[model samples]
Target: MNNIELLKSSMINIVENKYSFKNNGLFQTDIPNLDFYFSSEPTEFNAIIYEPSLCIILQGSKAVGFGEELYSYDYSKYLLSSTHVPAKVKILEASEEVPYASLRIKFELEDIYDVIKNIDTNKLAMNVKSEKGLFFDDLTEKLYEPVSRLIKLIDKTKEEMDYLAPLIIKEILFILINDKSGYFLNKFAMEGTVSNKIVHAITEIKENFNEKLNVKELARLIDMSESSLYQNFKTITSMSPIQFQKKIRLEEAKLMLLNQNVEASEVAFAVGYESPSQFSREYSRMFGMSPKAHAIYLREEVS
Candidate 1:
């Protein structure tokens, strides 16, 4: 078999042999905030909103839609999200013979900042954009080796986990920073950096998504000019500030509708829309179906 096929086979073997699948569709490990998965069926369309994280797929393929942009990657690629963004992801390919397996590592900004303190700043690239939050890169053998090793650690005893997991995690981050796209990762660690400012703005919007927000006020809050905020907000989030807020609102609405059976009008008002008609218009545009219809579709799919 070719290299890609070999990598796929090895990854599937490691996951199935070393880890036990949990009810939540992930394999548990001793390491906190780290999960693994091996799947053989296409995943349903779902939204993922999370902090800085890395996802490496060892086999099969998945598609992620961020705003109007769609990214598809397989065994040959990996994905990184530096900020919380509303995205719809679906596994496009998997099978019992060639299951789709992935490793997901979540980390706090402070941990990364602590690690950056000892590293030389000169190692990072000079030019980095604040608004470029998601990235995908080609996978190499070097990168795959450590992932394989990390999976092996799952079989070790608790004592071994304490001594070995931290080292493995550090090494993984080191590899990421040393790669060609390391500049983006580096920017995430720098305080008061442009990317950090954008992150701050994102935090504000997330916390106050239901509140009426104006461009001028948000720009002032982040110490940026309104025009600059508009430009950079689009750059970092791939959407304008209003668009970003609407995306967050719609995502939350989807969750509420699915879990709480919230009426469409109540959901609209709860998420900051003063006009139900306008909310429905935007919601349908983003999700492809009206809120009521989407809710029904989700319920049927889950049932």
Candidate 2:
């Protein structure tokens, strides 16, 4: 078989053996940096917080929407996100005969930095405008080989995994830095760059999800004017600062409602909404159900 086909075969084998559940869910891998996702059929778009990671599709198509753009990738393609961005995702292709299977591999700033440190930074462009933090690119054999071995490492002896996993991961990072889409990620990793500054703002909004957010203050903190901050932040995250904060709040509220035996009203307040009605209205708009109803639905889904 060809390299691409061989890689897919290996991915399908690992996924079927480790994450064969009929329902849609994330299956944790032996490595902390990796996870497998399975979906049996098409699903509605659901809000998600995507960390810095690379998502490789093994067998089906998926759609990830952020702000006004929707990115779709299948077995021949992969998605990369350089920052923690909130997005909406849906499994667009799957069934009993062919389930949607994919892998999510986490990456850290340190990984990117380590790979770029020895490279000549002068060759990297600095004037590139920040677009959406994530991009879809065609998968290459250069990337897939390492991924294949990484999957095989999961079933290896503990000593083999501990010694080989990091090396494989570093190779993956090296491949990413040389990818056509690496320009955006490289810009993100460079110290004191505009993209890095905007990342700081994104981090602040996420960490202070429950606190009052002032765009003016955030701009000042990032040492940029409000207009510059607004443009770059939207360019990178695809949402206004306030919109991002609201998403963070509602996402946190959803987790609390689903995991804790708390009332919807209490969740609203805990997530920084002063008026429960306002919270309910916004929550329904985003999730398509009342918080209480959604919580119940999730419970029934698992049970």
Candidate 3:
């Protein structure tokens, strides 16, 4: 069969199996580190923070903004995020006729290291320097097979699943390590590398997102010069330190607005925005509506 036909078939089977489980915003497989989503409608402007994961869209398209760069991925392309960076994501297209279906496999640095130790290092290409948190790469049939097998394993009994998922997981990583962007993944997994240091800064920002930060202090914390820190931070996150902080702040404010009846001013302060007007301005720009209006619209949709 042709590649398109193969992908369609695999997607159909996967969605059928996904529906067998309890329906939610996201679904995790019986195996650890495997999850999929069947989003019936497009998502709104929101930032999701997650660790290194591979995301493949079987149908429809998504637009993800990391720092300043926006990336769109469809069936022909896949997204690989090597670090946990805050970013906005909106599902640009989806419907009952063509629902948005995606599979995300989370990879642990330890797991990648273990696989690297066993494999021949000479097979990997030279490391490539990249600044964007999101990467879009062409998908191949060989990459599809391992993912398809993992989805198929969802139907197996617990005993069969326990035995087979790890092998499949390792195979998936092997395919990724040999792909065009494999070096980025490889560098991320290595200790004491520039990529590793940047990963550390990302972790600090995520853990202390609510706190006011100083660039020099953060640079010292990560043991890098101010210039080196600024360059590396912008490279990996696609935004400067202040910009990353604002993204996190805005995302937090959005959650508060949706989940609570708190005043906009209170939400702004809570998210580290000292000026409510500044928060409102940034919120309107990001969501294309004012904070109060956006909240009301969201509430009306739910009601």
Candidate 4:
């Protein structure tokens, strides 16, 4: 087998052995901020907070939608969420015999900055396009070694994990930033950069999606002018501020409706919509059904 095939086999073995076979879903590992997933079925787009992390799909394929663009990755590529953003994830492929096995390492923004600080910034290629909050890059052998090494630490002693796991995490981030994606990662990591400011905007909207958004106030908080914030924010998130807020609110409402037993009007009010009619209208438009019907559809999907 080639290097990627070998890595996949190793990863599948580790996850399958580590997890109990009672069910198939996200299985948190002993490592902090590191987790694994084993799934045997495809799913509709599920909204989530995509943290700044590195994700590798060892077996099946996956795709995440940031705004309108859906970025897909598999064994040959790694998905990077440079900023914390609201996203929708869909498992594109999985089966009983060939389940979707993947791992995600959620790292802090400061950790990325610390890695870049040690490496001489002058050496990094600076011309790469600063893409959206989430992106895909080719997975190389260099990158795979550290990731595999990190997973190997899962069954080790806590003291060993405390001392070595972090070093491996930093090493993985270092390899990522030194590659073509470095420019985009570096741009978002630093303060005062346009992308960084836009990230701040995204965080604010996410935090207070229920509140009425004041675009000018958001720009001021991030030290940006309104037009500049709008342009750069759309360039990164692929939607305007109001549109982004609406999507997040709706996603949050869907999350609540699916998890909580509540009326659609209650969810609308909780998610900041003033009128139940308007909420029902928008929810139907976005989800292709009324809130109650959509909930039934999702429930039927699970059963």
In terms of TM-score, the best-performing candidate is 2
TM-score, one value per model: 0.81, 0.95, 0.82, 0.87
- TM accuracy, model 4: 0.87
**How high is the lDDT of residue 36 in model 2?**
88
What tens digits encode model 3's per-residue C-alpha lDDT throughout 17-95? Answer: 6573224257777888788877767877776765688888877799987766677888888888888766778988887
> What would you estimate as the lDDT of candidate 1?
0.77
Q: Give the runs in model 4 whose Cα sits over 4 Å from its true position.
A: 20-22, 44-49, 63-71, 86-89, 127-130, 157-163, 296-303
Q: lDDT of all the models against the reference? A: 0.77, 0.86, 0.79, 0.83
How well does model 2 score by local distance difference test?
0.86
Residue 116 in candidate 3 has what lDDT? Answer: 77
Residues 118-168 of candidate 1 have per-residue lDDT tens digits of 677687786745656888999877777777677777777878877887777
lDDT (Cα, 0-100) at 73 in candidate 1:
93
- Residue pairs clashing in model 3 are 131-235
Candidate 4 lDDT over 212-281, as tens digits, reads: 9999999899998899888878878778899889988888888888888999999999999999899999
Which residue runs does candidate 1 get wrong by more than 4 Å?
1-10, 17-32, 36-50, 64-70, 86-90, 95-99, 128-131, 152-167
The sequence of per-residue lDDT tens digits that candidate 2 reaches over residues 1-303 is 898898889768866876674657788877878888888888999899899998998887989998888888899988998998889999999998888888888988778888889776666655757677887889988999999999887787878888888888888988877777667778888877788888889989999989999999999998999999999998888888999999999999988987899999999999999999999999999999999999998888767
Error of 3 at 51 (Å): 4.2
User: Considering every candidate listed, which one attains the maximal lDDT?
Assistant: 2
